[model samples]
Target: MDEKTCRFLPAWDPVLRFLHWWNAAAMTAMAATGIIFMVCGPDLPEGTEDALVSIHASVGFLFGAGVLARIIWLFIGTETARWTDMLPISAHHRKVFADTVRFYLRGFRGETPLYLAHNSFAGPVYLGFFVLAAVQVASGSSMLGLPEEIRSKSMAQELHATVFLLLLLYIIAHLVAVFIHEIAEKRGIVSAMIHGKKTFTDDERDSILEAHPLAQKGDFDERKD
Candidate 1:
């Protein structure tokens, strides 16, 4: 296993990538429409606000469906897609999280730990996103048919706006971190989401897959001769 040599292995599965990009598109649409309402104050000329609301609601429903499917997949999807792999609660994962923080603190100058799927630090952040998405979906759903007066003052409305802001912040931070990780590690972090593969050195790959059996490549055999 030469230090310069690397192996391309499975990271995200097909279903995971599809749901990821689908939700990303849906969120972008929701954010666009939401920003319009926030900027124009819901008093757009004629029926413009209504039209935006329709678009927002339709996209929100699709986002909600995608979120639901993702949650279900966390239970039944591939090993990398499962909840166990995405929670940063284990001792090993906590160490990975600490090392990741140090990697950032050092200005991306040193070697960072390798992960086949979501990095340990990112796993919990993703879980938080799902929680925020759930709240966003529930609050938005509750406002669907309510009277304008109640809708304006409802708890649902408040939660919806707050979750939107939180998600906006999350998106900004996520993008920055991803870009930095891609540049620093040269691991194809951005492209991996699209192609479901990541490059790892032979030693890194073997050690990671061996430590986390579930992270083993789906098509790779582990049986000893």
Candidate 2:
């Protein structure tokens, strides 16, 4: 569609976009190194395993810092990027969440709820991801800091591995959901993350303008600035 005719809304701020990508890259690196450490460390030449472990630890620290920055941004970010936006606290939000669930349960047959940012149903899942990441950091740090004898006896390693597996599953599910949204809804789900804007259909724009006038205005102002 032509720019003059199409309605584009700012969905993610630059900082949010940066965090999304930074975290994605860091997580992917950590996952790769972690898997190699777990699966190939035993067979690798001497010192290689230790190097991998060191690399994983360094990446894990960076990822932890990114997570902390994200948490801070949750409070300072734009309306759609705030923690409140991801939570279904209001009745309207809950209803939309239910509708979103129904949209998927019915095999994408019905109208999907349009969101300027994340869908209501995804808020809880995002929260769960944050919690899972925190757990991973904690478990990993605990294991890394423990003495060799204590490390062998402690459950931190097991907890760390378990959380990493869960994180892998979460990443896979997240990718699948992104593809589903891209193919089924044609929402530019992936591009939105990269470019920080979401182009809405005429109907979607109208719905958002009517329901969230202030939010629309703020988005427009931010884009103009």
Candidate 3:
């Protein structure tokens, strides 16, 4: 491929990328503390459990704030980052969603549809994750507010645990998918999240730009002819 035929395109904005990694770190910390709590149970020293709980709560609060920031960005960010971009509201997008699913089902061996932002199928899943996170936050808050006598008996802890488990599974699946894409498509999916840019061939860039005109707003159109 000629050097001119490939160019770097802005994918994630700086704020969005920062929030992504911030939430990732927060969640990782929360997960680690949670696992320790689960494994140590009541056998640990007197203050160990309380200390773990404190760390978990602190990271959880940060994660919740990050989620809120992301939700606000959905409404105020660029077209690629907006809710409309992710949702399959049009017939064309719905068709693309179906095709993307079919491509995945076929073992992801071939070129799947290229999307400048999140794929049509992934939009709904991302939305679902947000909802789940909100629920987990609410339940955790409720658990913390309850009196000690009732806290253990309250359903909030169970609900929070369930949502956390679901979120963990989602995170695992998401990481696996990214890994597969890195190996199969080699589109720099992970690096794009880190550096806020993606490399694309001329044909790929043309197709993406045709589908998402707003993507050309930033450095996307800075390519040499």
Candidate 4:
């Protein structure tokens, strides 16, 4: 039988918590722009059209900065924030990821792996979406930065339009994944990222960090992936 999820486990470090919440807030702003950008499509109230695009561009810039800061922190940040922690590490991990997928797809949770930080099962899913977010934002920024002549550039237009289309699809996929993960798995992961702590069963916690002496220490948690 599965251990009940903990209501009070220490989850993320302070820095990790800060960045996560900050990024989430930025993402919300980006999401708003995403909707407006899609529906409005260069259309705005007569007096505020330019103002709206400017706001969109400014928000894009802010989100881009957040993304860049995250990259730098990925290199110099705390545990639970490193690239490796976010990605799968072994065959067992691959299996866990696959099983998680199968569990979601087939509506069966039998034999799923337990994870402390990123569940081996969900690791790749998180990594994939993060990558998609990075690409979407990058292409979105390029689109927003259309210098007069570059505005008409075929490559710029293609990148801007194509990335937007793909980003829309990715957003839908991301939301669906979150809802499914939440419903079937009973993990409020999206809200956890907001709250900055998730409870793990006692054994699951130990088994995961036991292999890495360094990971257990807050001092060494900042080491590169």
Backbone clashes in candidate 1 total 0
TM-score of 3: 0.91
Q: Candidate 2, which segments miss by more than 4 Å at Cα?
A: 1-4, 145-149, 213-225
Q: Residues 15-107, candidate 4: write the lDDT tens digits.
A: 666665676677677667656756885566755766666776777777677776777766787656666666667554565576677776666
Q: Report the C-alpha displacement of residue 31, candidate 2, in angstroms.
A: 0.8
Question: For candidate 3, lDDT tens digit of each residue in 1-225?
Answer: 456666677778888889889988988998898888778866878698778888888888999999899889989987678888788885546766887888789988776767776778878888898889889878887776566679777788888888889999989988887887667755678998998777778887776666664664544644554
TM-score of each: 0.91, 0.90, 0.91, 0.72
User: What's the CA RMSD of model 1 in angstroms?
Assistant: 3.3
State the weakest 10-residue window (summed lDDT) of model 3.
Answer: 216-225
Q: Is candidate 1 or candidate 2 better by TM-score?
A: 1
| CA lDDT, every model vs. true structure | 0.84, 0.79, 0.79, 0.60
RMSD (Cα, Å) of model 3: 2.2
Please identify which of the two predictions, 3 or 4, would achieve the higher lDDT against the true structure. 3
Predicted candidate 2 versus true structure: per-residue lDDT over 36-75, tens digit per residue: 8788866988688778878889989889988888888889
